[model samples]
Target chain A: MVDALSAVFQRPNFLAFVIIFLWGFYIMVTRYNLVKKLVGMYLVQTSVIFFLVSISAKKGATAPILLSTTDPVHAINYVNPLPHVLTLTAIVVGVATLGVGLALCSAIYRRYGSLDEEEILKRLE
Target chain B: MSRHFPAILFLLPLFAAISMPVVCLRHRHWSRPISLAVLSSMVVLSILNLNSIITHGEVRYAFSGWSAPLGIEWVADGLASMILVTLSFLGLLALVFAGPTSPKDLGGRIVHYYTLILLLISALTGIVFAGDLFNLFVFLEVAAIASYALIGVAGGRALFAAFRYLVLGTLGASLYLLGVSYFYAASGTLNMADMAEKLPHLLNSKAVVGGLLFMFIGLGIKMALVPFHAWLPDAYTYAPESISPILASLVTKVALVGWVRIIFWVLGAKVIVNDIPVLLLVGILGTLAAVIGAVLALNQRDIKAMFAYGGISHIGIILIGVSQGNQTGFVGGVFYLLNDAVMQAALFFLAGMAICQYGARTVEDVGRIGKQAPWFTGVLIIVAMGMIGLPPTGGFFGKWYIILGALEANNYIAVAAVLLSTLLTLAYFVRLFEAIFRQTPLPSDRLPSDIPFAYKLSLGATSAAVIMLGVFSDPIVQLLLNHALPPGL
Candidate 1:
């Protein structure tokens, strides 16, 4: 248990990912403002993206650029590139989601005259 | 050229969507025809793809000349191709039904409507064909984004509903991505087939288990399996008339299919059923959804909301079949998926038509509809019978197989849920039938306008397909579903 705790503490990125993710989820569930909820969702998505990018991280590894002088077989010299590529795509999807979410928020605000969840529901009733 | 059909299935719509605005610039009236043409061709191509898959087995197309595992691929197995055919077929019918209706409903935004619909169809096709996890996630997001806009286009309470869907949907997709990240970290590959091959060796790993759990939660939210179903009723209720059937029938169904693929095809049923208690959990949740959705649907006054809740109930039934974790169970689940798609689409279409023609927005308002529009009433009765799981309807066969599977699995709770939900379904639908056939007409009742020929044709086709599915369930199970079954099950 001590070793596992130390290992988890050593990987601060993963720890931070978890913290940020939970924080975002809490805000998403607890917040009444629609825009704040969107912000929470954005944070949640980006935290996941952070986790993905951190999965590719290595202690002393260089970027995955091919070098003529470097030994190609020594793949340990470079960080994994796949997760970086995935993170880029994920980032795009995140931006699109945020854009859509904010657009919906604006529309909701226009129609309901308020962005608070309670206010909107009451008005709807 | 034939091998490229899977790529074309999605690319055709995507390109059409991109060009829809430009095409409509010259002539405002051109958007509907262009959309119809694109969707019709999609249906044709999907049918051809299904035929080829049945004859030649699974087709894999790698992007940019790269082989599988190194680059992205699209796989069209029997199940994927069947889903493709179902999606495009329903999409075509929905688009056809939307043609005359959307202009009046959406006013000047018809162009954007077609664009978003085409984009949604493209994304759905991509989801069906995606051979890798990340590709599936991308397609899922594209579909979600388009649907968010589509739902919001109604621009009232719909906007708030769309916002709610967006929040939950993004969170779900993010969780799914987190799960994918875990899988990637453990397996070092994103290709689904490769990940499957690597997963068994890593089955003991905590990351693998955690990944599976996250994926289920994420997908469960997307598919709106009860408890996670908070967003569905409002989204379905408030969406514009033309868009409701498409969103109601295809979006959630595709997500469920994605979940099945991940659980059965990628993770393998042995792991889910034996190594873990995931199937049991699914069975429990499904039973809850079945009972709860039916009970909630029983109390709804708004016709659309009632059908929306009924949709949740049917999804629960499908999940019950899926959770049984056997070949018969899988067949039942898949069959019910198809049946529910047709049934929900028909119900929403009829509801939308009733609203448009007679301003009948509630069960009480639709009283004596049977006397005025006999054909409409007849279709409603057929759909209601199917929903009640009466024999000779598609819904009956799906439930029959599910019950048989549950009996085989000795899951008595699920069995009771299915039977109880069936009775509840009957009770609610009997009320609808009584309203349509027996109750006196409201004082404000007026003669409904004649429905367009195209609308009638789509309705006729869907109703016929529902019965045909039941009549031919045996052949479908034998010829298609047997092949569609994943290895071991």
Candidate 2:
């Protein structure tokens, strides 16, 4: 099994993909409540983030620090930091979306006086 | 430097979005022009960008002059450009609809609304343009955040609807991001074209299937594919009349396009067409949404809410075409999307006219006012016929192509669903028309006596577009299909 997993990682970008997408699936399908649902959703989005991050990964790569830190410009063995950077922006945007959604949820709870979907629908009817 | 204007077109909207609140901080009324100017320029820019891509085929620009996989890339392939241009036109039409039918306090929220609109547009444009998967996620977040807020802004039932959307939308967004992460790890390249180049090497792997499944589920929420569409009806029903067109017109289309790009391009034909159960999932789910949406819509009292359900049903029909993964099927889907957005926007706007002119909230109150408002009803009928997919309207063309594609694809059940829904869709809207137009006006609207000419002009413009796009679908389809269809299924 370890060999299978290691082999999956060796033949390209498989292991990283597995870990992220699975984690996302686990979160989204399992969560029930509204905020929890959002949490699950965020977990799934992590698969996308991981997918992006993994693309920039090299077999023996490290943090993508600048070349000048070593007092030599010839060597740059850093992992691709671009996906990480992209995810950062995505993360901020995601947080803003979460804030808006939460604000809306609070308002819904106030107006309809419930956070449960069944209860809300029942009251709405 | 000059080649970068299309990128700037999107950037301008985002920048303006950030500045809009500040600009409106003192003089709130000024936000409309800012909104108008942003939309007008976006439309113009989209047209130019679309023309370039169609005539030229695939215009890609690197951020800060960096190469793909190493640097962020912006792509103006035919597909994205088509979606962008159509989105722009729809945005303008929705704003026009909003300007007339919505509450007067609209201006109070103008700064925030327009800012969100511009930001949403900017993000959608980026999603289309981004050659990289991570960029797509980022753009999706930008658009999604704006939409979640826009849904809740109207208050009342809107908060409930927006809350539902937010929860579901967040789940979907995160899942999509997770899928992107997986794809990135496997491929070592975030660029879509690069992934296509690399994915074949990792074929028959569980990780690929895993990634595809995650993406489908995530995107499925946005596509509102039957079982996953729990958030759609409420979100659409409760959003302001002004925002409905944008929500109904652009939101789902963007998600659908993203789905196609990722599923077909990133995953490839073998995976989407034969492997990984996409066509089957799409077909089954699409058929269900089509049937269910129309059935539910048939029973609706609120015209907007009914149309919202009808819109989802149409999405099902569209997915059937798209899921075939054939060029013809895909092209038909795009055409269907183009027409549906326009026709739907027009009809919704007309509905808005009723709500604005009278104090009426539901369809039960739209009685005999057609005689009082002859022009409104006349435009309404044109838009209605468009929804019915009648002759000389874009809506008809939308149905015709999809039906044709379904038949060609030998998806008889899907084709049947499309045809059946047309009658059902017509039945509800026509009933709406009769309720309002058929009765003799014994009473006038309790609200305003006359709607402003500006609103009418915009409504008329959208109605005209419905007719024009139908008659000239060939050129429009040609523009959309030329670069929209990638090589192979």
For each candidate, report its DockQ versus the true two-chain complex.
0.89, 0.56
Q: List model 2 lDDT by residue over B205-278, tens digit each.
A: 66667777777898888768778888887787767777877878778878887777877777665464335466
Cα deviation in Å at residue B487, candidate 1?
A: 0.9
lDDT of 1 by residue, B46-80 (tens): 88988888888889999889999999989888889
Docking model 1 quality class: high
lDDT per residue, candidate 2, A39-62, as tens digits? 655665555555565566676667
Best by DockQ: 1
Candidate 2 Cα outliers beyond 4 Å, as residue runs? A1-62, A66-83, A109-125, B100-107, B270-277, B444-448
Candidate 2 lDDT score at position B299:
91
- Largest lDDT belongs to which candidate? 1
DockQ of 2: 0.56
Candidate 2, position A96, lDDT: 83
Which residues of candidate 1, in runs, are more than 4 Å off? Answer: A69-73, B272-275, B442-444
lDDT of 2 at B51: 71
